[model samples]
Target: MADTGELKQLPLKSLHEAAGAKFGGFAGWSMPLTYPAGVMKEHLHCRDAAGLFDISHMKLFAVSGPGAAAALARACPIDPRALPIGQAKYTFFLDENGGILDDLIVTRTGEERFIVVANAGNADADEAQLRAVASAFDCTVEPLDRVFLALQGPAAAQVAADAGIDGADLVFMQGKETDDGWFISRSGYTGEDGFEIALPAGVARAVAERLIGDERVEWVGLAARDSLRLEAGLCLHGQDITSETNPVDAGLLWAIPKGLRSGGDFIGASALEKAISDGPARKRVGLKPEGRQPVRAGAALVDGDGNAVGMVTSGGFGPSFGSPVAMGYVSVEAKEKPILAEVRGNRLPLQIHPLPFQPHRQRKG
Candidate 1:
């Protein structure tokens, strides 16, 4: 949705078209908004079976050198040096003021090699910041252009097996490079168990065709992806989180290890430490509106006296949950009863429900 300057197409554009995709602009890419099955059906199908998505718009970077881990630690809060080979960790890049610059997945492929996957909107800035820090550590940051596909759902493992891809040994947050140049990881935006495959563009179409050939697999688009992630209580970088949001207030402290919280040295350590000690002024919480009407993002959260307390970041109708779910930031003092959301100039009754309207069925083992 950002500017859409000369939209770029993914490698599987033709395949999506064949699947009856309705295209729309997102982060300067002409991506599919939905297929013939629509967002509701696609969202439910993924929960029951498998949903294949083209997430190639995300940026991938290869950081390798003896100082790769050190370089990443300086830029991000996580201690990459402690990351085991073939393991991946979700973390964030922070500005000096402790605000999150972006959230990313860092996979340690080797002793001195890692693959950093960042959001598309922040790619340019991420690459620049990484390069600036990498140079000081004698590390090299190389941008990679490849096809990124996510196959997610309850039956995703069987579908991958049907395609002759051996990922049964991998659990959540684990990835390994195949002999044929494919990076298969047991991770996804959806809470369901699945694998994300990154491979060369030359064989992308063939691989997608092979996967979708199964009866259980269906092509999904951005619309369903957003709803699915919302149901899973996952945060979208630019929307739910931004450069103005810090890890503590955003409820992302779990992503940062305790060691880092106590004594770690990183870009935003001081600010984060202070926030932890002082406590967050506002905390991210789940909102359950009373009616069937979906509460979209940017809706203001107010108190009984109609005073603005917080704002909704991600909100929508969850297909699997069968209810309108939303997540937003609320002031700590205003985290009281009778929280209302202003809809069409009318304050509607809502409750502070726990996050993740649905349970995460991730294959942790």
Candidate 2:
């Protein structure tokens, strides 16, 4: 239980409760922690079948009017001007000091319209910054209250298509706004072929229920989401990536386009330029634990001589890999080799590995 008061419930709270979802507090939202099938089973289900997740707690902000894309590019490093219509890019909102404010998925919905899906905990801050930027332009920034859901797994697309949703033709990282007021995107946190839909409030439940009626779909919860994302090597905002972290140190250099990295009018351009020239002393890396015992977040990572170096940012049992997988910042010196994670005063070996502990099965066009 979190010390925070007044945990809000999702629009699908009643639906989740009826399906026996375990409860927990996530960003002031009383969200599902797990379900009757358990986290492990749900995790596997997302790999083999499809798992439905209520992600309405996450914010959806609309930025549009005129020159919206170029207007937004000032704060976000990614060139929204270059993002094609119907395509989405995973990028971060950087502060003036080059620190990551919040990572978000911004999808270009139209000629001048865009929708940003931000992390739940950082939604308020994200919108505030976006509003600050919009005040200088001819655009508007409005937060949305739609019900967001993730249909994740190998069978996610087929099931959603079978249910009459608009996802079968969409490629990875693509979305199209429907006349029914829902935006369907073929992307997910888990490294799988999936779709995330943002639906109107009135039809959210009906759409979700219809999809789950298929034999390939099941209700999942936050626990499975955490493990699935960890296996996918995706960073969890406020954890693996923080306000103090920069994209260079976070191993997300790929998100920075070549032209942007060298010179751009982006918010964090100056500081990121320095980081790129001097090189970040540390980098995010993946670790494979030697045994079945799981390494958890914040576990102390040490060097061979027991000197503290870094800490585990995300760690868990990878059901697909059938091994414990962990990821964290390690000194560049130890990044290419094995290291140790101190758990309960016992140092456990963590072999250095590349990301995506579970292979991604994106259905790219």
Candidate 3:
């Protein structure tokens, strides 16, 4: 276990404490698990209003040089050279055997410049991987000096406009660096119409204060954040995806377009291309438990004879759905075969459905 004292804190740590946040360790950061209102309220508030999340633990990296785009294509499955400026893409870094090392959002800033926002825990390794790719091209990959925050919900745009950010016009998957140097992306993990703000640490607090002061905005912690993403049927990186799994198993083949320029010949591309055509042995799916207790990650998915068929990746009581929802990898045969989830050795009937237990509110524009 990592030492609590060694955990880093968000730039708004003092503010979070002032707001009565209960802190916990996440990806080596001392982040809030919830505020005084608690996880349930925080989750619901993000569905009805706007909830502010201090995601500064996430790392921002800038890649640029004459061959940056081509270099990126060689490192990942996507062809960054064909990406339009301001466009954002969700992609994964893989090992030579087609296992997911990390998944990140890459935003094209120019013809040869891009910014990749990586998950907190994988930041160091992600940097090393990007640098490894850099050796093959004339590019520089380095962390950006910015604090990242996520503002999500139905009223998210209004809250941003009310705070004088003037970024309500941007739609999903688009990002722009403001004249003030704040990078705002019209995207979020909650599957809502929202924005992720990357700003200078010095000024982030002021903007956060301005937004939090609004009636529609309040501090939400990682606990609620997890439930929100689970309800939306989104993957939570370390849990749902890892170096042991490939994109095909996680239902992320769409991120790597085979027909387009594709994740061609990149690291795991050989195996991935074959897996894409043959289909994975198992795929991620949603599960609706038959009883009250919610199944959690690592719970076994079992067959009629109590043989393990798969394992749960994420599970919890979805505040919005008013029931328990979970995601797991089940045998492709289990898609047609009746299965049960072993909960504390007791068998609970499982109903398989397509991903995203709840509706995705993310705007296509």
Candidate 4:
């Protein structure tokens, strides 16, 4: 166990305390688990209104130099050369054996520069990998220990517009640097309209204050964030994907560029190509529990005969769906019938459903 007091703090730490936030240690940071209104209220708030989240613990980095994009392409499966400026793509960093090191978001900023955002827990490992790649390619990698904020919900666009930022013009996976010295991206974990803002550490506090000043916006915590992402069918690193899993089995084959499917060579390209040609043995699927009981991660997913076929990776009550939902990897053979999840030593009936449990309300423009 880690020491609670020794955990790192975010720029909005004081604000969280002032708002009576319940604290929890997450990814080596002391983060708010929920506010005074509680996790349920915060979860619903993001679905109906706007919810502000302190994502400062996420790692941000910038890669630059003449061959930055090409050099990064060698490690990542995405075709960076085709990614336009101001546009971002969800991709994976793969090991030599084709296992996923981490799934990341990479945005092309210029011919020679790009911005990368990665999970908080794997920040050091990601940085080390990038540094090694840069050294080999003779490029430059700079880590930005900045503050990041995610404003998510159906009313997120209106709130951002009220704050003098026009989110309607920003399409999904697109980002722009605002005059207020913040980089705003039309991306979020929740299946709703939102933006992730990256700003300097010094201005993070003010930005949070300004956004929360709006009556439509409330401060949310990690507890609701997890539920929102799970409802959205978004994969959580180390849980849904890891060094042992390949992208094809994770149901993220669309992320692989068309050109790379054949000739474009990159790290783990051969294995990924083979997996694409020959289907994976198992696949990720969503589960709708028959009763009100919520299944949990690591629970055994069994067939009617009581044979274990898969394991739940993420599971919870989907606030948007108003039911118990889960995601897990099941063998392709077991996908034909209604599966059963072993919850608390009882066989709970479950319907194998498609992903994105809640419909996405993100703006198309």
The candidate 1 region of ten consecutive residues with least summed lDDT is 1-10
lDDT of 2 by residue, 89-108 (tens): 88889876678898888999
What shift in Å separates residue 322 of candidate 4 from its native position after superposition?
Answer: 0.7
Task: Give the TM-score comparing model 1 with the true structure, all chains together.
Answer: 0.97
TM-scores of all candidate predictions against the true structure? 0.97, 0.97, 0.97, 0.96
Q: Rate the local accuracy (lDDT) of all candidates.
A: 0.91, 0.89, 0.87, 0.86
True-structure lDDT of candidate 3: 0.87
Residue 325 local lDDT, model 4: 87
In model 2, the Cα lDDT at residue 275 comes to: 86
lDDT of 3 by residue, 1-365 (tens): 34569899787889999999888899889988989999999999999999999999999998999978877887788888778899999998888878999999999977778989999999999999999998899989978878888999999988898788867768899887766767888889998889999999889889989989999998999999999999888898898999888998998888886653233757788878777777789988998887778989989899888777899999989898888889999988867877888888688888886667778887677
For model 3, what is the alpha-carbon lDDT of residue 216?
90
Residue-level lDDT tens digits of model 1 in 1-365: 34445899888888888889989898878899999999999999999999999999999998999999999999888999889999999999998788999999999989998999999989999999999989899789999888999999999999999898879999999988766767888999999999999999998888899999999999999999999999999999988899888989999999998999965768888988888888999998989899998887999999999888999999999999899999999999999857999989888788888878889999996
Model 1 misplaced regions, further than 4 Å: 1-5
The local lDDT score (0 to 100) that residue 347 gets in candidate 3 is 89
